[model samples]
Target: MSATVKPRYQQLKDMIIERISSGELRPADRVPSENELVELMKVSRMTANRALRELTDEGYVTRMAGRGTYVSDFRAKSHLLEVHNIADEITRRGHQHSCKVLRQSRQRSRGKIAGALHVEQGVDLFHLLLVHYENGMPIQVEDRHVVADFAPDCLSQDFRTITPSAYLTKISPLQEAEQVVRAVQPNAAVRRRLRMADDEPSLVVIRRTWSHGRPVTFARLHHPGNRYELTGHYSPPGTPKSATGNVVELEIYDHE
Candidate 1:
């Protein structure tokens, strides 16, 4: 009751975001178009457009020039994936999993996201943005780009219910994946999304996944350093058997 009244467009944007968070706006559900908003909310076309634009930027909806806008449901699910899946990690801890899809669309791959896939600049790629949850707690934010040719069904999948990681592995088996980790500070946008204190540090992991001997996707996962750790297993090209006559096939690497 005490909340102050915000601008008309901002109020509209917040209302849309609330609907998305409450599951009222299901994934892939189209929201009221600008024209509809102008009529229903008695707001100007510019105000309605601004609301929709903010929603799009916040990853609640996907806008297409001729196709209109629809809710996004992208998440990263884990499946013992020959690759890491963020959503799965939360479930493994006995936590209920969820995600707020920020964005999902076909974009021209470039820079590192392109380099990891070994694709040419402007190659068609599926880009995704999501904030991951565990037991209703925000844990990480996943920003990723996938090879369209490898997971053609990606856009159609509901990321809210099923993690994109799970969908990808199901459609195209993963052959190998490589991950790199580092520490960094959050930017203004990341800081706001993660709801972190100004001084809190963060850990970032970049992963490249391959399928059928070709790189298929690249992702950057961000986590609050204070609340998370990274773990993995590594083995050298070849190693002698141990004294117990067991081959050295596994090595646990837990990085905090």
Candidate 2:
């Protein structure tokens, strides 16, 4: 029996991915062109192109029409059970996080927003739309509305320097939190802001927080599915013992 050998294109792809994982190639760093790869690796242009094409499809790289291929800016996973600031999450991954306040103003709470915040349909509410980026790549679109009375200064604060989640936590203690996760195809506006393809689905997390039994904030966070994921670890209660008195370990993951 002989060991199987990989195709030249696959070998090339693995080499490039290794560079990326090793920190030798960073986000936005241009990868070698197909012609350059062909010259350096002594492979045909078709093989080189296939390697780059596969990388692009797998979300490891992106190619521009006029420009060249560059390493992709991918997502950093954050636990769904935790209520941490997005800036902190990005920084924990050793990447720079930036926020762009797309829109911030006082708007009348209406429809679903009103219901979620437990406010009257026509009552004034603080609305903030923000786009958060990691290493200069857009990763999340946060559309949040706060109960006006809960955070009186919500509309006046500079969200670019401080995230809405952090600001809300500072103003009031979180007594309770509720979250709903779903997979959906983003709307045109959201797709444009996230810079994702029209057919690409997104992971949407709708979170509502309350302070002292009063609704404080409701937020809809959208993350591109290919670039982001939610993960959790759980252990069963009451460890079981085997017949021989050996301890048993149990772990479960719910991908619901």
Q: State the C-alpha lDDT per candidate.
A: 0.79, 0.85
Please give the distance, in angstroms, between residue 167's alpha carbon in candidate 1 and its true position after superposition: 1.1
What local lDDT score does residue 210 receive in model 2, on the 0 to 100 scale?
Answer: 91
The local lDDT score (0 to 100) that residue 139 gets in candidate 1 is 79
* Residue lDDT tens for model 1, 1-256: 4678788998788778778879898888998888988998999999999888877765668899888879876463232313347777777767888899999898998897788899999999999998988777677888889998888877887889988777777887746888888899989787777777789888888888888888998888888876766654332112223424533445457796
95-166, model 2: which lDDT tens digit per residue?
A: 999999989999988998898888889998988899999998888999999888888988789988889888
TM agreement with the true structure for every prediction? 0.57, 0.60
Query: Please, what's the RMSD in Å of model 2?
Result: 21.1
| Stretches of model 1 off by over 4 angstroms after superposition | 1-84, 231-256
Q: Who wins the lDDT comparison? A: 2
Worst 10 residues of 1 by lDDT: 234-243
